[model samples]
Target: MTKPKISIVIPTYNRADLIAESLESILGQTFDSWECIIIDDNSNDNTIEIVTPFLKDKRFKFTTKPLGYAKGANASRNYGLELSQGKYIYWLDSDDIIHPLTFELCINEFSWNIIDFCRFQRTVFFDNFDVKCFDNYNIDENVFFIDKSHIEKIINNELPINTCSVIWKKKSLGFEKFSNELLYAEEWEYYSRLVSNGLKGININKVLIYARKHSCSQTHEFNCNNYIRVEAKKEAALLIVKNLAAKKMLTYSLKRYFICLSIGFKEYNLFEQIISTIQISSVEKIKWQIFYTILPLRLSLYKIKKAIKM
Candidate 1:
């Protein structure tokens, strides 16, 4: 009945199986002053069955609609915004969950500083933690102090702060709008906008969220992995050419170059993929542009790592 300080938004589709655990985690949170909003993208499953019990709490609600990720997530967020009396917003995917005390702790931590957003360090569960985070190209960064400058450095340096481990003020939505065109690169593009709007993010020294992975996910479905590493770099170069055409600032040019290089050298073994994608002069020209494409055949074994999908 009381107005809350935080609104937790979840968007799901056919997640009847895992939704309960996520809800249970929230219900068990030590923080009592919060509400949860679930936006069902017109699922045919018992997702409603899983959420039905929580309906009595004025804090819990749901919306059923036919929407995919880009539109679905944005619509759900806006829907939560309309229902929420909270000044702060937190988004959790239906397949992911919050720490038992996450809302309580993060809200308390918000008072420590005025921030546009906060990013969490993740602890993934890949058949449990015994295996290194590297098993799936997932990383768990150590607790460290990060402020606005650090975030700026991260943005410029090509490191990322993502939505899973991310929370931000509900008000910031008014300044910059979410994009509807992008399904995959939305995070990168959105973060770029948030930063461009002068909103700063900090890394909370806590493991606040868990990102789940399975064969059905985008990571597993990324059919371009064979060319992903190489294509990523080519994408960077193309992005740069576009940036120059658009006359955008070159502040991160070096960073972009390395990102392109990193993708080409470390992420893919795609000579044929390159020929198919790029029509830039001769093979020798491509080699001249690339620093290490000329490495010995035996060295091809070095760049075979893939990032964990969440």
Candidate 2:
């Protein structure tokens, strides 16, 4: 059998009802030289039964997460990376839909040998399939080069680059792996590493994927627990700051770290550790110290504002 040019790695858990649509979208792709690797993370649902019909096509491969492996999307993705034999890697979630021309359009950009990755926009859909909104991160540029400012924007959460909307050359990824320990914000950390390491890529300025926002989504679940989500964001922020420092962006890193510390103020011990460990101007430090002292009042005011809005 001929080797596929692109490997679409999809990590799923108990997505039996939604995965069929994702698989069918892949089957409908305009590009033919691609393989779909569905890594099941020990899903007890009939995910296998739903995907079985698609296996008739040799390009659609499914594997269960090995025993003792971490149980999460990141671990499943890492496993899929190990088993992938394609030249390029695209990460797709089991509940998302890819446009029929996504692979064709992105792969065309690789004609330039210097390109290491490509990213496109995505349209987010609500649970009822209503169009919630579109991510217009790079919608203006035909092919925008990623620079320090762009990296900073991404690290600061000012940009929207989801896993499904990006594709990377397998060789450019080297030994990098997503953080399996993080239940949230793993993508932010992983992408920060990629950008800091000078992984050159372009944004296609087109929507090529449909990201579904549902009650059962991981982000939604994480958001329901503010403390857990904030802690995870802090961890991701720490990693990004460390990477930025390595790249000689100390001031920016400190500012980002400060923001993270502010957000996770409820986690006093962790917040204090981060404040002490990260370097900042003495005046800035004093300001944060004052802010920390008034953190409770700030939180109360924030709650009041939110309650008023509601």
Candidate 3:
């Protein structure tokens, strides 16, 4: 049997009802040279039973999360990476749907493998089939190459790159693993490392995936008050800081780290942890302290505006 040119790795956890749609989307893809690897994170639901029918197709394969591996999507993705036999890798969530031509378009972007990855845009849809929002990733071109200079745009949220929108070259990612410990902002951390390590990419100004936004999503499970989520962001920021510092990128300034920390500041308790983790001048520390003091009020106002808009 010939090896597939692309590998679609999906990490599923108790998504029994939703997994079938995602699989059907893959089956409907115009690109035929691909394999789907579903890594189940010990799902207690009928996820396995739901996926059984899809196994009839030789292109679809399933595996349970190996023993001793961390329990999360990132860990499951890493395991899928190890099992992958494709020239390109697409890490997708079980609940998302890829457009039929998404793989064909992305794979077509590679000209002699000049681009290490290709990131497209996504549309967010609600349960009622209403389009909730569209994330353009701030892309203005049909296709554009991304390098280290764009790192700040990514980290500062100027660009929104989701896991599903990206298709990576296996060779460029050589043994790279997503940070298993980062429950939040793991993609940011992983992409930062990839860019810092000199991986070039292309961004397609087209929405090729439909990202489902439901109440049970992992993002909805955490709020500003969730300490674990906050800590995960902090850890990711710290890792990014260290990576940037090693690259000697001047963008790794104290102010930038403070901005990253600001995302996690829902309460005063996490301030000391932030200060201890980030290295900054006394003046900058004092500035951050002041910013932290006013964050609660600002957050309240933002929430009010968000509710009004909703």
Candidate 4:
């Protein structure tokens, strides 16, 4: 088989019902020089039976996560990255579907420009709804040149980039991999490291992917495991904060932003991790300590005020 120009790596769990749609979308791509690798994360459901038909196409390959490997999308994604044999990488989820022209449009942009990656817009579609009911999550910028300010904006949520909406130049990624330990915001943390390393890219300004929001999705599951989700965020924030500090791009607002992510969680040790990781004056440290101490009381007062107004 000839080496493909693009590789679509998808990590899936118990998505037997929806995995076929994602595979079909890939099969219908206008651009043909691509391979779709589906990495299964030990799904007990009939996910294998659903994906088997698609594997008849030479471009569609499927593999199961090896024993002893962690049971999450991060580990599966890392494995897919390892097995990929393409110049560009696009990570898709099992439950989502991409537009037929997704590959063609993004590939054209890469051919015309020198970039480490290309970012595109994605729409959020809920279950039991028409495809036309999707909502576009647009980024406010077009050209995302890697710089201190751009990186800060991403960390500050001013420029939100979705994982499925990106096509990454594999060589530009080097040895960077997702944090397998994190179950939430793993993409945010991984992308932060990539941007901080000075990878420049352009935004395509088109919605090429439809991200499914359903009860079974990992993001939705966070509602039940709130602590697990926040802990993951804290871990991801620590890595981002330390990376920014090392790059000398750490700012007061950025530090405050990450620190505040753990504010209401009441995890003192995790909060201290961020506080100690970033360089701050002793006086500022005292201020943080005071704020953390009174956080519960402050939250209670705010809740009371809100209740009274309501």
| Prediction 2 global C-alpha lDDT | 0.80
Candidate 2 weakest lDDT stretch, 10 residues: 129-138
TM-scores for every predicted model: 0.68, 0.86, 0.85, 0.88
* 1-310: candidate 3 lDDT, tens digit per residue: 4899999999999999798988988998889999999999999999999999999999999999989999999999999999999999999999998877788888888764778999888777877332222233343565678887787777776676778889999989987899999898789889878977888898888778888888777666556346677677767777776677666663535444545465556454445655665556899788877876787688899999999999
Compared with the true structure, the alpha-carbon lDDT of candidate 4 equals 0.82
Global lDDT of each candidate: 0.59, 0.80, 0.81, 0.82
Query: Against the true structure, whose lDDT is highest?
Result: 4
Instruction: Give the clash count for each candidate.
Output: 2, 0, 0, 0
lDDT of 1: 0.59
Candidate number that wins on lDDT, 1 or 4: 4
TM-score of 1: 0.68
Best by TM-score: 4
Per-residue CA lDDT of model 2 for 144-201, tens digit only, reads: 7664457767766566667888999999999999988877788888987887788888
Tens digits of lDDT, candidate 4, 128-207 = 42545324434354544444358877787777666887889999999999999998989889998898898888777677
Candidate 1: misplaced stretches above 4 Å?
66-75, 127-148, 151-159, 223-249, 252-255, 258-310
Task: Please list all clashing residue pairs in model 2, or write none if there are none.
Answer: none
Question: Total backbone clashes of model 4?
Answer: 0
Candidate 3 lDDT (Cα, 0 to 1) = 0.81
Q: Pairs clashing in candidate 4?
A: none
- Cα lDDT, model 3, residue 279: 59
